[model samples]
Target chain A: MRPLELRRIPLFATMTPADLAAVATVVEPVNYQRGTVLFGVGDPCAGISVVLDGIVRLFRRTPERREVTTGIVRAGGLMALCALCGEATHRDSAEALNHVHTVEIPTAALHVLGQRCPHLQEQAMRGLLERLDAVNAAFVIAQEQIPVQLLYLLRSVARLDQAAQRHPGDTMHPLALRLSHAELARLVGTDRATVTRALRLLEEQRLIQRKRGHVTGVVLSTPDRKVPV
Target chain B: MSDGGNRKVWYLRHIDLFASMTDEEVEEIAHLLDDHHIPPGVALLDHRDHDRVYLIKEGAVRLHTGGPEHQVTLALLPPGRMFGLSSTVGDADRTINATTLLPSYICFATWPKMAEVFARYPEVMFQLTRSLAEQVFRTETWLARLGMISPTARLADLLVELSDEFGEPSETGRRIRFRLTQADLARMIGVSRETVSRTMVELGRAGWVARESGRLVVRDRDALKMQANS
Candidate 1:
């Protein structure tokens, strides 16, 4: 694997050039094959993982063993940073959706570096704060109706694939996660038929479109989808 | 802060975000804060404004989004909790709206003031990061319960948890400290007010709970426990 670039991760974005050089030596780049299970729920969280390439999905398994996705991370996304909150274990399992590459920095090392590096912990906290905001929104959105839930999940998928899309703006975000209705249903925490009907409704409203040349590809008609959700 | 300057230092000492700071350093940050009281229902933080930091001195704040008919309640924060993470997060955008759930005394300061405190006492920044991380877990725990549980079970479990934290012994049962409306209960459990009202009626019929002078009384602890676990 290539050496990790400390500056690429938002948690280390504020480190000065000298400080960044010092920090780069601490992060270890790791690559996982497609469909690799990165971490399992309740496993001791070793440190934060900063994605450098490809996508990772964080999910939970129900009592009946159904996979329900909580969030997604692509290149430049950070995972397990919440361990800074002193959690003992990973709250949700994470799996690589493709051939994912990430840089792992031990929690203790980051703290030690924060003590030496100016504006490091502060910048990291800002990133975590934004994540807290996203999770807080998810808490509320989980209770909403099916259409609202689908739209919200679509928006999240749109974000993961933002860099790949040529047309980027407020409206019509093309999705990259070519997941089937069953997978999308899992992401939205619903049944396949229900998700299928909801997608059709969204298509009827022109809020999304089935992507060309892919059976399961769905694109957000408008990324800034304002609703009661 | 009607009690004046010394009192400001007193409140900052209690906030978890500043728990690692020395009393002298707490006093220094206190002097820079503008303390004010917010009436219930008054919006405290606008999502667009990210340069100010708020530390709750007294009462509660509701972090939420959406409008009247479809509003979603995020978190009901208690005293000693800090908001507006500019000192820790830098120039980050806030996603949720915060409003006073009760008449609240809040101490706020510009990001520059907070930045100086963070720079001088890096421990305070560490504390805030840990605190926000805890908030993330807390919210996720709530989301999991709200998404997966039955309405009856959610209410029973909520009442039990709230009672554990805020209940006091009464003649017939334990009385919850706060006066929570059906609407409030509904919001917390991610159910409808009608559902809460209907469930309350059922609980009342089953001798599980009662309303005593507008406060909720858990009349049968064992029964509520059984229902909660079921």
Candidate 2:
């Protein structure tokens, strides 16, 4: 796999050239084929994984063996930083959704690098804070609507993917997210029928179009007007 | 109520359960205050064990599942929020574990003291009951989300709730400044990590929201509101 440019990553955007170089030294690159397990639930804490390319899915299996996706990693983002600070092991497993390129940085080295690199430290701390905030909201999400929950998830990934792009604000930039409808339904905690209904609803509204096995030609609707509940 | 050892007067005053007491009454109740410094990362209450109630004098408290993974965070309660309120009514074990976010002071109160207060002061009893009811409502709302809704709908409801609570007025409209991540949403919705990933992609492409700095910027609050509706 071709190496990704570290300077282009939003998580690294604050880094000076020196800071970037320091991070490059510590992040060890590795590649995995599709459907490979990067880590398993209850596995010992290793370190954080930064996706250099491709995609990795983090999920946990229920007692009945149903796999639920906890989140995914494309290039330019970090994963599983919260577990490393404490002794808790991975609560879920990470599997490659496709051929993936990633950099694994042990928690110890990353902490040292944080002290050495201001940008890296800021990034790591910010990520942890973000995770904490997310966990706080997750508390609320565990109680609410599934489709809304799914929408927030998509909005987050889309933003991160856009941020990781070389030109973030350019209109020509489009996020190509590939996943199937069945997978989409399961992630949203619904079945295929609900997914199809929701997708058709979006299609009728011109918010999106479906093609082949993946979603395509996406456009966000305008900001909604506040309606009386 | 009790100045109790020259501690700050506000600590005694702010707690609604203690707020109305006169200095004498506060001091009398202060006799019940058992101060202890809990070290960081220790569990104060175990699941299924309802031994005592803690009033947080200082320090942060987080409620987590009693399971092995402890992946789920139920809530983060700061001072003024009663810890272990459930124990005030019954002898059941705690449903969640209370862990100190920082090394801090906690007042250990027995059920007897709690009963004394409730019986002696009908006002305190009323306020405490109302507070407990609100918490129960919030807990039920959270469980309902995890048990019923899809991830996107759950996320949408969360956004609506956040927007209602914390959203600020901006040229773009009421913007929720708090940031959240996809992984967090996945865990919250109890779905696979990939499900969150794909759903987020689909939503973003459709302009329901925009992600920024790991924050879900609600560019269209109305659209989100519609999606949030069950």
Candidate 3:
């Protein structure tokens, strides 16, 4: 990537032109197909991958082979910076939730660049702090009712609609969520039957609306006008 | 430096973040820390207090969230671990309240001081990043356990984990030195106190765990490990 392109990232916004050029020399971009395992638990940490596009889900599998979704890394997010310390292995598995484009920074290169540029080090620290926020949020939601938990999950994974961005006067911001009921159940740590019931309740409350013929996806809108569901 | 300052520097060197640093660097970081002696039942870092990190030098601290009537214990941080990391990075607010479980000795550093140290030693920044990431991974695992597993399994897993983190070898098996109540265990596992009570009774009857003077002693390590994975 060009230094100009690297400068576009908020994490690199504070980097000087020369620093960006130094970073651009070492960073490599890679693409991952959907469902591809980026790295697995116990795998050696090659470096850090920063999401340039699409989504990556970090998760772990239980002894029974049940996959538990931990958190999703969206655009401009950093992955596995935690393994850059003295540790040699990844703590959990990261898979491509969709087609993902990421800039891979080798561990040695990151160390060199961080020493040369304090801005990058601060940004990396801030990124981990943001991730901690997400983990804490998930822990809090785990104690809520199934429906509330489902709603929280949807809100977390939903993508903002372009239309809402174009119209500043619009009161509602539409968000698109693409996940099957089973997937939603897995994310919420509940069964499909319970998910179905919860989705129905959310729909009745006008908090979520399913797209026609898209059984696996739904759209949620901000409450523009309050009407009793 | 006084004897107390030397002792504080000694404790600082044991922390993972400072363990690899040169003695001079550790001393520099130690000088930035303000000593605090907090009694039990006092909030060391309350919810919403930002821009400070506390390194526990001695005693236990409980990190918890929610109001008193419906609070949850996030983790019991032991000596040598740091808390309030969220405040050092940016505007992110602390989600949990950290309270001393026993009379404790703590060392604190403001965000500016920590940032200065990171700028001086970038490797420390990387180490801190990795530490926070480990914290995230652990929290995610706990959430998964709370959401998917049975209460018995959850309790079993908690015991096994705590023993590994804070245990000292004993004649029977391993003893968790921390004094954790059934209510605190319930909060950690996101279960009811009654559930913890019943599960403890079952484990006690099966000779897996025993209570000695309000502290838990893991008597049968193999059985508890099996229950944890079961």
Candidate 4:
């Protein structure tokens, strides 16, 4: 394996060739087919994993047996940094949303890597802090009424996806692509019927265009209007 | 230690929120208490205003408000949870007025000191944020379950939650030693007291549950599980 390619990952992007080689020594590369279960709740997490390619969805099954998708881990982002410190248990399960490639580094190797590379240490610490902050923020936002929560989340994920564009007459940046009704509903914490009604309301105001797989564009429309459920 | 001092420590120990805090942190926080004791019937955190946040160290505190005809209990914060977070978040005022149910020893934390501690520890900040968020979600979830779900379904969901939190293994079933009064059940599920009474009676008759003096003996866990599924 060409260890030089390891430098392409965001976490190791700043490290030198020598540093990457040191990391490549302990990193075990693994690939999975779509729909694979990487781990489940209560399984011992030996260390952190970084997505080299493909998407992984992390979700928890509530006591009522409802499956709540907490987050999706995309390529270039690190997953499970808290496992390194052994502070959090595997409260959620990780499943491959698509055929995926990841590098699994044992906790011992991560500590040694951190000790060897100050850059990795700082990156890991900052990443963990930011992830915790995001999770806390998500918890707060999710508690709102489903419609309010969905609109807020759509704008957020749109911005995160880099499709956000400021419209002259509105406060929120309109997302350039239309999120499929089902995908939009899942993110918004509601059923498709509610999401469909919400989108239609927005469409009537010309705030957004609804198309297959994407919205044509977001436009300045009106003030924040509550979707009548 | 003085009688008052030892009682204060004993009270703080029972609060789950304080369990993770260090002794030094507790000692530092205790300095804010001022050895103040309020007699029963006094309002600690009045409805609709910013004031001191209190941690009960001795005696019971009933979080309630409204006039004689409209009064309701929000919570009976025994000794762990801090009350008056509305003030911290800039709520116009406390939504529920806390009254001394019995003579109580309470510790007060001024806003500045609270901010200082939050700034000093990221872990504390994370925990506090998550805890506050969870409290809001829990309250909302309870309200939604009561409003949108059937009483039997709500009771089933409550059983599932309690089983996860405090169930004990038994020969017949996983017994839940829940010590909630009928009034507490009404407040928790956001239903009328009478509805809670009727629901409990029906559940008992259905053989899904058996009620003792103040606890629920879940006899048919599988049946309740089916109800939750349905």
Candidate 5:
């Protein structure tokens, strides 16, 4: 992406035109098709990748070979700055949830840019902290009842839609979730059967909606908030 | 500065975030830090407050979440390690509670001081980023084990990990110097105290680990390693 385009991203928005131009010089644009493994666990971090388009799911494989979905990075979000930091190795694997486009900045160059623009460092740190908070929150949510946990998962997914629709009038938009029941179970740390049962309970309470045995959409009368589970 | 204060500065220099810094830079950063001596069982950071970061100088600390009955130990941080950065990143709520596992000495730096340091030495920011990444990796690994492994394997894995990270060579074998009770082990591995007791019995019968004076000693490293992977 061009320097002007990079300025729109919050991480780079604070940089001066000169600094943005400098950052654009080091920016490498890359694309991946759906289901592409952008990086794997134990792989050395190539650099920091900022999502310009599409979604990337960061997950870990359990000893049983089951995939535990940790969190999602969408357009305008940065992926795993932790990897670029001291360890220099990815802690988990990242795969594209759909056709993905990213602007990759080498760690070395990013450090240079950080020196010139302190806000860049602040923004990246804030992003990392936010992710750490989300992961820890999920750990706590794992202990709650299945239906409560499912509601939390649904709200997490709906957060993306809520972010995409920032207009005040769009608060009532129907948020369509694209995850399967099995996928939802994985995210919520439960089995498919439990997820199915919990979905019915949530539907009974009018907390969520389903179509053809899959959670297709949800309507939030207010701006989406984290439902305590 | 007093000798003790000088020693605190020395400890700060060794932290990964300040390791690359020059003595002058370290001294400059050290001026912004305040030393604290936290008693065992006292919380250094509450889950509700997330404004300061601390670097362990003398003992260990446990990072946990939830109330007393449902607490889960997310990590056991040793000397030279930093905690509370997640709070300093933004106005985010502290995700974990940090309690001193033993009488500990730590250096506290508020978010503003930390930000000033980062601005002066961007490399320190890079180092902090790396440290946080390592923590994320470790937490992810623990979560994966909790979800996929049996309770026996989970306890075995935690023992081995703690031993590797904090153990000292003893005449008999490797002994974990820190005081870890069955309840602590259960919290660390996300199991019940009863489960930890039973697993300890199993491990003890196998001659893999033994407890002495409230500390765990690993007798057969290979056996414990085998059980952890099994």
Candidate 6:
């Protein structure tokens, strides 16, 4: 909406005032409510969007048409940057986790402006590199055995919530998140029955305790183990 | 092209980051690349922006995590692909080890040197971005395939991907550049070695996969892809 607002985004933070203003002029503010699909796989990458508020989920469908959550982004995060900058089409679909606000910079304008601004193009390259590295880690967590898999996934989500820092010195982390078995299955790419089985196993080992059907907390048996990422 | 200098130019051109550059520009930049040969099974130390970016010029490298007792192969780096940026993954604060899968030739340049070239030929940023983005999509696709319901399906998915990424046309079918041991296949798919041996035997009987000059050849890629989805 405003050039100052655009400058607040780190991607534009290093740009000269002239370059920032040129980019700010192209950003179109868009908003969505919870449960709305923002974009689907194969959609032309319209442009890079910077999240102004709320959370968004990025996922890809399995061959069986099951949704497997890949990454989560909150306010102050950038979306579609890698696809818009690197690829022609969006590789994954995005959905609003809640009421969300995002501003998208039109591709044509960004391209025209990028030719004159090295900073914009450099930031996009750096962002793509970071995204690639982050997804690489997620793939590692996904391959861990089921019970350990769920624990890692929770910790991952908590990292987004900044909840992990709440117990910085403690072994146990209270997730305080309520998710249905089906949702849990989607996150881990397993069936609800398998999720139930894994949850039971985690409970028996005293690694996790559920409260009122919500995952209350988790305990890593060896918190100081050489983290294999 | 037989000379090291000319061969290096050819290899550098194959990399997407340098694909769109003029021959003269490529020749100029090729001189900036430092080359080295590594024996199979040797590990690469972590490389950062200052240390330099390395690309596989010949042979393959394996990226894996976990201790030696339980190593899981995450990816097999094909020629023209870069290495080292994957040194860290998220907040794990740990390093992913890369070991040479075969005797290899690697070419590298520090970020500062690469940036100088990028400044000189602005178009390279686009190519580099596309290269990085495609890598992200491939990694994501590999992640999804690992979630398939059956070990057979998982193995099929892996085979189809291997042929797509690192295989070449052969008399029998698509011959994978790397000779993967059944043990290597097992470690990659996170299944037991015996399971990989049995699955390979089955695929061989089905006429979908075969061995050629010690490399894997995918004879029926369409059928293999179908099985991967099934």
Query: How badly does each model clash, as a count of residue pairs?
Result: 1, 45, 0, 6, 2, 0
Q: Estimate each model's TM-score.
A: 0.85, 0.47, 0.89, 0.53, 0.88, 0.86
Error of 4 at A227 (Å): 2.2
Per-residue lDDT for A43-119 in model 3, tens only?
Answer: 99878889888888888876666777778788778887644664667878898867889888888787778788888
B58 Cα displacement, candidate 4 (Å):
7.4
Report lDDT (Cα) of residue B105, candidate 6: 88
Candidate 4 lDDT over residue span A22-132, tens digit each:
888888888998779888777877778888887776665544555555655666656754455453455457887667899987877865676566567546544543443
Q: Could you give the DockQ of candidate 4?
A: 0.05
Q: Model 1 in CAPRI terms: which quality?
A: acceptable
Q: Write the per-residue lDDT of candidate 1 for residues A53-146, one digit (tens) a residue.
A: 8988877764435565666776776688556766668887889877899988788787787788648777767666666766766666677788
Which sections of candidate 6 miss by over 4 Å? Answer: A76-78, A81-88, A162-178, A193-211, A216-222, A225-229, B1-3, B46-50, B91-93
> Which regions of candidate 3 fall more than 4 Å away from where they truly are?
A159-172, A213-229, B46-49, B87-95
Candidate 5, clashing residue pairs? A85-B130, A86-B130
lDDT of 3 at B169: 86
User: Model 3, B81: alpha-carbon shift in Å?
Assistant: 2.9
Candidate 2 chain B: worst 10 consecutive residues by lDDT? B85-94
Reference-based lDDT, residue B122, model 2: 49
| Per-residue alpha-carbon lDDT of candidate 6 for residues A1-229, written as tens digits (9 for 90 to 100) | 7788777666777888887778777789999998798988889887878777767878888677778777666665667755454456787888887788998877677667667887777877777777777677777777678777786776655554555656544366676445677777877777889888888877776666787666777763344553332
Local error of candidate 6 at A158, Å? Answer: 1.6
lDDT of each: 0.73, 0.58, 0.76, 0.59, 0.75, 0.75
Q: Give the TM-score of candidate 6.
A: 0.86
Query: Top DockQ: which candidate number?
Result: 6
Estimate, for each residue in B1-230, the C-alpha lDDT of model 4 and write its tens digit.
Answer: 67866666666656554567777665655554555688877887744445456666666676654444445444455544466655211111214567775677877876566656554533444344334434433333443343334666767776766555446666545665435566655655545679878988887888877665546677787888778657
Provide the RMSD of all predictions against the true structure, rounded to 1 decimal. 4.1, 20.1, 3.7, 8.6, 3.6, 3.5
> Against the true structure, candidate 2 has what lDDT?
0.58
The DockQ assigned to candidate 1 is: 0.39
Error of 1 at B32 (Å): 1.5
- Worst ten-residue run, lDDT, model 3 chain B? B86-95
